[model samples]
Target: MPIIVTPRHNSPEFKEKCVRLVLEEGRTVAEVAKEMQVGRNTLHGWVHQAKVMSEAVNRAVEAAVAEALRAEREESDARAAADRAEIVRLQAELATAREELAKLKGKG
Candidate 1:
């Protein structure tokens, strides 16, 4: 007689599908578990784990956005400072040109 064996661990894709069926289809864990031949508690645990992972992913995304914004702001500030320096340099050059013109006029 051949012995029967069931796998102990479910694949991540299967776990995701089971979680989605319960979450997206508005089905009860027990109902989905019964249909899928999984233990009710195991399905419930999968759902809980999915929710936790979703929250963690959301937090990570928010943090990344904030970091990107901070870096953009710093870059903008640096550009603005460079612009101000260029403007000051141009103003000083104009002043020197004006001073030279005044001296030439006085000498002429």
Candidate 2:
């Protein structure tokens, strides 16, 4: 059996800095990889994460999106409920009117 060991990574801040440089600073992944002495695939993955990963600054943006979706769904549900209520009310009214018409015809 052979034992395997993984290389320890740089600090988070360093990783963040490099990722940000590759992503936000428009640095080429290959260039960053060469600078960091890491594989291009590794640098590309870091840059991709930097671009997509949600951060504290983006928390409000994500929350606003969730709230907007919830509000839109709530509005749709409320409209559907209102339509159902209106249908029931109209049906009951129709039944009552029919009964009254029958009573009037009997009196006539």
Candidate 3:
């Protein structure tokens, strides 16, 4: 006669904590799985899932940062354009004032 063993079901929170212990706490999957009395392969799968989720979050953050940088650059460009226009207007006004001064001096 052959003997068989039944598998045990663990809670989702328990699985997440075990995965965190291996991925975030710097513990080996085998070590944590042993401590938790689970199979090494099972813990590895959870760790893999966690890594995939983390990668997705990282990509989203990078995209958001890139968008913010682009928006800031656009705002800076608009400000620079406005400054240039103001400079041109001031130069024109200064030239008109100089011309008026020259006329007054000629009359005197």
Candidate 4:
């Protein structure tokens, strides 16, 4: 009989599912490895790697959220400053109008 070999190229999604099966489903590494036709050590590595990657992703997401909040706060501050400046301009315009009206009434 001719020898046939199975390719060892497992996709990341497949590795994630296998890791989930072992971790989330509470299945033994050996059992999942046997069922999935993967080596026991390989599956264990996948599970450990998944945990490490999860922590890294969580940290990255937290940093991204913090940066976004900071940007939003800065934008809000800028808008508030602009609003205050506009209010001051409007108040000055109102005062000038009042002075002009007083002068006109005195002349009348």
Candidate 5:
């Protein structure tokens, strides 16, 4: 495949589009290359020099956020389980107390 030149290095639309492809598109590099109709090497160069660094940083941030969310959900689940266990324990204690009170009132 021949090399395809994108119009100018500073076109806003062009820069935004390339950034979108690398970051948010979720497509493979080759897929974006084909879709952009540019040579894969050229596009790779554009990405590497331009948006690739930011994209990689954004991915790290996203991963951190997801890990935190998962941990928070697990903690919430643990708290709910503890609450249920405490409720059961209190119910059992109440039942024992009621039985003792009945025996004291001459109820066998």
Candidate 6:
């Protein structure tokens, strides 16, 4: 005859803490599960869920950083355009002033 085992229910908080002990506290899943009196497979599943959640958060952060970089590049391009226009205007004014000075010297 085969031995039958009953399934145990654990709260969300309990599962989270157990997963944290394995991930953050450097404890093994088998060790934690053994200490917590839970099944090793169940603890492993919690750890897997935690890893998936962490990867999702990392992706979100990377996307946000990429967006910020893009916006910064756009602002920089706008500033460069404005600076180039100013430089062109200043050069034209300088050329006109030089021409006037040359004409006045010639008249003298």
| True-structure lDDT of candidate 3 | 0.86
Ranking by TM-score: 1, 3, 6, 4, 5, 2
What is each predicted model's overall lDDT from 0 to 1?
0.88, 0.77, 0.86, 0.87, 0.79, 0.88
TM-scores of the models, in the given order? 0.84, 0.47, 0.81, 0.77, 0.54, 0.79
lDDT for each residue of candidate 4 in 1-101, tens digit (9 for 90 to 100):
32222454277777877898988999999899877778888889989998899999999999999999999999999999999999999999999999999
- Flag clash pairs in model 4: none
Q: Rate residue 61 of model 6 by lDDT.
A: 100
Give residue 94's error in model 1 in angstroms: 0.7
Clashing pairs in 1: none
What C-alpha RMSD separates each model from the true structure?
4.0, 9.1, 3.8, 4.1, 6.5, 3.8
Q: What is the lDDT of residue 14 in candidate 6?
A: 78
Q: After superposition, how far is residue 37 of candidate 2 from its true place, in Å?
A: 20
lDDT of 5 by residue, 1-108 (tens): 665565753476775686578767766768887876766776677777666677789999999999999999999999999999999999999999998998999854
Q: What is the lDDT of residue 94 in candidate 2?
A: 100
Better of 1 and 5 by TM-score: 1
The clash tally of candidate 5 reads 0
Mind giving the per-residue lDDT tens digits that candidate 1 earns over 21-40?
99999999988987777888
Q: TM-score of model 1 relative to the true fold?
A: 0.84
Tell me which residue pairs clash in candidate 2.
Answer: none
**Model 2 segments beyond 4 Å from truth?**
1-21, 24-54
Could you tell me which 10 consecutive residues in candidate 5 have the lowest summed lDDT?
1-10
User: Any residue pairs clashing in model 6, and if so which?
Assistant: none
State in Å the error of residue 1, model 1: 24
Residue-level lDDT tens digits of model 3 in 1-108: 222223342677888888889978999997897778777887898889889999999999999999999999999999999999999999999999999999999999
Which portions of model 3 miss their true places by more than 4 Å?
1-12
